[model samples]
Each structure stands twice: as C-alpha cells, then as structure tokens.
Target: MLHGAGGSGEQVLPYFTALGDRLSMAVVAPTAQQPVQTTSNLDLAGIFGSRFRMPRWDLAGRDFPLAALRWALTELGADPNRCVLAGVSMGGLATWNLSMRFWHSFAAAVPLNGALSIWESFGTDARTRALLPNTLPLPLFVVHGGKDERISPEFDRESVRTLRDLGHQEVEYVEVPEGAHGLDTLGLAEGSPLFRQLERRLCRASRTDQSASISHRANEDTHGRAHWVGLDGITPQRTAEVHARWTAADRVDIEASGARRVALYLRGDRLSPGDMVTVTVNGVVSPVRFTPDLATVHHTFQNTVDPGLVAEQVIRLDVPQPPGDEPAEPTNRTRGRDAETI
Candidate 1:
C-alpha cells in the first residue's frame, strides 16, 4: 500500500485499522520524499483540484519509496509472489509504473483515481509511445470516480481499453458514481467490494504456482508482451514478414516447478496449412501439426518434475522467416506513454 502526494504512510493506518484482523498480512507504506513547495500565485482550491499535479515519486529516475518498499519486504519476510501493489492519486501512478517494470513480482495491482500514464501531467514524445503497452496482462483492479475532476476518469478507461486490445484477460475496472478524487465516502469495511477484490486476489496467489505465459497477439499487435522469466541462452528476434501474426518460429519461455504437463493453445486462423509448432521441455522437443480446418490447436506435453527444482521450458514455432531481418527482441518500456482518453 502506498500514499498519494501531500500524504504519508501514516495516512493509510486507518485503512489497516478498518481491515482489522481480516488482513493478516504485513503492510508496508513508504512515504514520498521531498515536500511539494507551494507557489502563492496558484489558487489553493485549484491546487487541491485533481488537475493539480506533483512530481512523481520516481520522476527523473529517483525511486525513493519503491526502494524502501523492496527493502521492507525483505526485512518483513514477505512473499514477493503474494504481494499486492496498490495506491491512490500520485501513488496510483507509482503503482502502475512499478508494476509494469516488475510485472512478474506481484500477483495483482490496484490503482485508484490514477492516470494510465504520466503524460497526462507531463508532455509526450515518440519514445514514450513505445512504452505505453508495457503494462500487459498483470491483473489490475482499477477504481476511479466518475465525477473525479482531479484526474479525469478517461485515463483509467483508456488503460482498460488498451490492455484488452492487447489480449490481457484479467483487467477489471470499477467506477464509483459521483465519487470524487478520494474514496473516503466509500466504506472500506469488510465484505465491501474493494476488500472482497483484495481477498480474492490474495487467495489466488496463495494457491497458484509462479508459472507465467504470454500471447502472440500481445507481442505482434499491441507490442505489450515483455521478456519471459527463467529464460536461458539467446532470445529470438521477430522476423519482419511475420509482424502481424504468430509464426511457427515465435517462442515463449516459462519457468515451471511441480508441473506434470505443459499446454500450448494456438489460434488456428493464424497458422497456415501444414504449419508445425515445436514444444521444448527441459531439452525434449515435440512437434505439433496444424490444419486449416481447425479453429484452435491444443498441444499438451507430458513431463513431470519435482517442485523444488526450477526448470526452464521453451516453446518455438517452425514458421517461415523473412529474409535478412533479425528476430525481433521483446520490447520493455519501463516508463509511461502519452495519455489517450476514452
């Protein structure tokens, strides 16, 4: 849990108190550094408005609270895999930024009344546009005020749209009717929607493995897929000719444990007749054939490994490659892109 600008970790104590013993997990709330100096020319009410912006916690590559949080997690013996990143306002922006850069580190994220990108307050450029899609597939539960004048609701809406367009399946957004920038009016008690969502996510984390997967549409169309975890050796380049679809040669790496089988689901329309995909698990490879008549192809590999041993599995397609073009490396943009309204 993180705090918004002009706020500190202390402000969130009430939320913890509200949760009581329902939340047994350790909480870490790091304060944002550097006081925001006020200017006399600015209207105090206007400054309090949602439109008024402050320098982000990590602006210009300074990561005060994030670094503090990471250290605190270690000291507290917290499970990184079960951790949740959440915040409001400027802290909401920090949540989005940190989650993107460390997508594999957390089970879920909740950003309230936060802009999808810093470009809402800061300006934009071509470089920033490339970074927009980096926040893909991580489960996000976004809450915003429909009547929020501080940071328009459109930013949150656009984020959901862009994520869905990029094939992310688990993004959820909720709007509080006539709600303002703060969630004070919305009860944060047990059985409330917000508490329920957090409970469900934490429960899922405790029961699931760390296995991660990426879709080709995320890579080719939206440029949203990041590098795979537990990857070994060399990474493949995306051939130029296969830019729009998943070819037989596209590959994804997954680090698995306590696994009995691996499943690969492919969109049939993307494959040409007689196209084949290869699934490699711990140095063993199996080839799968695809036909035009099929709408989806499900390939399963039978292999069992001990849960204690971390294994790296690679899946590559055997498709035609364009001449002279290097395989496309996965794109990773740690920063936010230009803001686009819904």
Candidate 2:
C-alpha cells in the first residue's frame, strides 16, 4: 500500500491493517520520500493546481518504493510472492506506474481514484508505446469517482482505454456516481463491491513463474529484468525488448532488440544438469550444455530477495547489432558465442 500526497504511511497503514486482518494478510504502507518539485513549465501551476510544493510520489524513480517493500517484507517475514499493491489518489498513480515497470512484484493492483496522465507520459513516445503492453500481464482493479473535483475522472477513463488498446484484458474499471475526491469512503469498506472483488481474486491468486515464457521491455537498467529474462548494454534513451519462451523442456527461443546481450536464468526444475539445452536468438541457434550451480541459486535468492525467483543456472548470449551501432561489451556475464545448432 502507498499514501497520497501530503500524507504519511501512518494514515493509510491503519486502514490497511484492518483490511489485512479481515483478509488474514500482513500489510505495509510506505510514504513518498519527496515532495512535488517545481517544473520549468508555467502551465504546471494551472495543471496541478499547486501554488507551493506539496508531497507527491516520485513517478520517475523506482528505488525508494521498491526498497520500502523489501524492508517491509524482510521485517514481517512476509511472502513476497503473495503481495498486492493498493493506493488512492497520487498513490494510485504511483500504483499504475510501478505496476507497469515491475509487474512481477505483485499479484494484483488496486488503484482508487488515481491522478494519472497515462497517454501523456507513455503513449507520446514510440518506444514507450511499444513497451507498455509487455508489463500489463497482472490483474488490475481501477476505480474513479465520477464527480471528482481535484482530478478529473477522464484521466482514469483514458488510462483504462489505453490499457485495453494495449491488449490488457484482466482489468476492471468502476466509476462511483455519488463519490467525490475521497472515493476510498466506499472503496475501503469491508463488504463493499471493491473489497469483495479483492477478496475473491486474492484468495486464489498465484504468481507467474520466473522461468516461464516472457516478453519484457525496458528503457534503463534500473527496472530492466522481467521474469527469467534480462537485458544489458542497451542504448540509452531507447527501449530494449526481449521475448523468450520454452519450446521444449530443453529448448528455448528468444528475440531481442536494441540490446547487446540477453540472459536466460534457468532453474533445475526446468532442466537437469548435463542436459544439452538448445537456444535460438534472433534466428541464430546455439546448442549449449546446462550446468547447475548451487552458488547461483544462493546469489539469486540474495539479490532478488524472493525465493521464487532463484535460478540454479544462467546463460548469456551476445546480440548481433546492425552497422554503425556502438553497443558496449556487457559488464555482467554469458557464454556460447559460437557453434550454431542449426
């Protein structure tokens, strides 16, 4: 859970605590670290309706919120795989942005009366537009008040429309006619429609496997990896994408763009030691033998802080770029540069 602008974690934590008690779950609400800063655009005053600096989520940064979540999970000994993210107003916008960047971090998301600028933020750029669909696999329940004064309901509606246009089918959008800025009045109630939906969905929720077939996109290294696939040596300010899937128990197919290297994190459950794993990247085939490392499993757990994401084996492949592209050598790791399989 996250708090809106000018709000503290204590404000939302109590509500989440009661809701968590009812649902037999643990809850944590993290406060935004920075206040809304001044922008050079003069229209910002009229658009945001702010005369002075006020608290707001840092939509551009991913570190603070993610670190808060890790801290909460560690302190409470909570199951990171079973987490759900929920927020109201400014926090709701953060919910949408974070969910899009890190879909694997939560099972579902609830954004109530979000102050969103979805099309303006992500749709204007061709690179961001292409990257949006890859991060929307998880379910979302979006709510907005029809009579909101501070932020218009059109924002939420347009966001939902854009999401649907991007091929997201697991979204539910609700508009409360009598509600105002504080839609949480109806949304947070124990037996409300929104609450009931959350109960039903969370009761049976299960996260997608990290080793499962994946299609992911990223612009920077801060939030690059998705599922079991990772990208490195990507061109700055350009979107890098990777699509990978298991064709057979020991065969994998991959496609990459705007990246100099792609990595596949394989686990023992998916493939055995000494098995000849066939990999195909951008129409290039390489047959490499699998080798499980116990240290990799431990390091993966340490780095990700999620047991479900631990991998016993890892394979890296260098991507072939067109002429005039100056992609650097990866600082991480990889193997199987030659010997075509087909």
Candidate 3:
C-alpha cells in the first residue's frame, strides 16, 4: 500500500500489519522525497497542486513504490510481478502511474483517491489524458468519496468513467459517504480494514504469470447503478439538538462490503410513494426501484466502481464522525480513504 502527499510509509502499514504477522507478507511504505512545509496549517490545496508538476506516477513518485515492491520481492523470494501497488492522493497518483508503466510487473494495482495530473504539475504538454486507459492487463481498484472537497468526486468519477468507457474490464471503483481526506482518519478507521481483505484477495505466489488469478473473497461487484436518497433531509440544528448531525445527505447508516445485492432504505418522510431515484456506482449511472416500507427505501447496485481498485486500492475511508460500530452514511462515503473526515 502507498501513502499520500507529505505523508509517510507508516500511513499504509497498519492495514497489513496483521496479515504480515500471519501470511508474513512484508508491508512497506517509503517517505516522500520532498515535503512541503504547511503555512498557517492550511495548504493542502497548494501543496497538492504542486504535486501535479510531473505525471503523478512519474519517476519521482514511482521510485519509492517501486523500491518497496522490490524489497517485498527480495524478502518474499518472489518475483516483482507478484506485488500490488497502492496509495492515497499523491501516492495514489504514483500507484496509478507506476502500475500503468509496469502493468506486467505487478499482480494488481490499487489507488486510493489518486489522479493523472502529474504532467500538469511539471508544465508538460504531453497528452496524459490520451495516454490513460492504455493497454495493460493488470487489475485495478479505485476508491473515492462523493463529498471530497480537496480533490472533488469528479476526479475519481472521471478516472473510473474513462477506464470503463475505454472498455477496461479489470477496473473497479468504490465511493464512501463521509470519508475523510486526511490520512490519520483513514489509517485508524475499522472500515479501512477493507484494504487487508483486498490484499489477501490479490495475493499471488509469483508475479510471473499474466493469466493467473488472485483470489478475493470480497468479490461482489456493484457496478451499473446509482441512487439519491436522503433522510427526511437531515438538519444541522436538529442534529445538534439530538447530539447528531445530518450524514449521507441526511440519511442512511449501513456498511457496504460489495455485496452482490445492495439494499437501500429511505426514511418515511424522505421520499413519497411516487418519488423517483437513481444510483451511481463508480461512474455507471442506473436508476433504482423503490420498495417503500415505512420511512425506509433501499436498492442494490452491481458494478458501479471498478473492482480491482476497490480491493487493492489503498482506501482511507473518511471518519469525520467519531469512529464507532456505526458506518458513515452511504452517499457521503464517496472518497473512500481520501476523506478529511477520517
């Protein structure tokens, strides 16, 4: 797994620490070459903008991810192709860039809230947009949050949309509600354990075989679906009165494990008998069927986000609200691990 900009290796370590203890897969996260000094403790946008100076996954960023993969290969006595590249934000950009360049070098690619803006950062005129969705057979999982402010949901949407539009079947997209953009929130959240499960699914003894399939127990695709359902529409004043705030556009409190079928529930007052709604998983837009039973309504989505990006993607599902047994509201969980809430 990889870390985000101005972040360190420790970011992606804990997710696999337990797995390393059992399967003994060595977990590695290298530091960034340059660190931007925060001004007035408010420079996420500026520093991140600077990251685009080069292709996100270009040599400057790829070096560490590559090094870590090399180290894992050496320690495991396995080929480099058996590795998985994953990261968040800038690191995620590196993950995508490296994975594309060395598609055949690894077993799978996982990028959490990453983009292809490296060329913009360096003032390069290369056709990066054209180069994306290139000919690569490796699987990828891309995660994002719907409410992400710094990177915005459109960034993740466009990435997945392009790949899907290009007809690349190996990609998967996941969006979470109320997911934070900060690394600290993502690294510690219990929902973030999805990474551990994802790694196990993509693990291979050797990276030499292209046709080999890594096993993923969490293979429930939620593609081709979308929906807009909120609680009677949450109100901030009402939340504070009850020690709560509106989440998921003011409704929903459930966890998603990519079930083959996703059941959505809406508050009674949220939608009427004739209300119409739809869902967007990844970028596949699809309307949902309403089965109102009280103030609750729900739907199941198949293959919305790319699957490859989900399991192996270094998702830092935001934890803006306190981390507890309760999951973030569904619609708000768009950014995956890139949430400032986490």
Model 3 CA RMSD to the hidden true structure, in angstroms: 20.1
Candidate 1 lDDT by residue in tens digits, 31-75: 776534322211111223344454336522235654654664557
Q: What is the lDDT of residue 112 in candidate 1?
A: 80
lDDT of 3: 0.44
TM-score per prediction, in order, is 0.56, 0.83, 0.49
What TM-score would you give candidate 3 relative to the actual structure?
0.49
| Cα lDDT computed for each candidate against the true fold | 0.50, 0.69, 0.44
lDDT of 3 at 120: 40
Report the C-alpha displacement of residue 141, candidate 1, in angstroms.
0.5
The deviation in Å at residue 111 for candidate 1 is 0.3
166-196 per-residue lDDT for model 3 (tens digits)? 7876777777666666544344244356655
> In candidate 2, which residue ranges exceed 4 Å CA deviation?
35-56, 115-130, 183-187, 325-342
* lDDT of prediction 1: 0.50
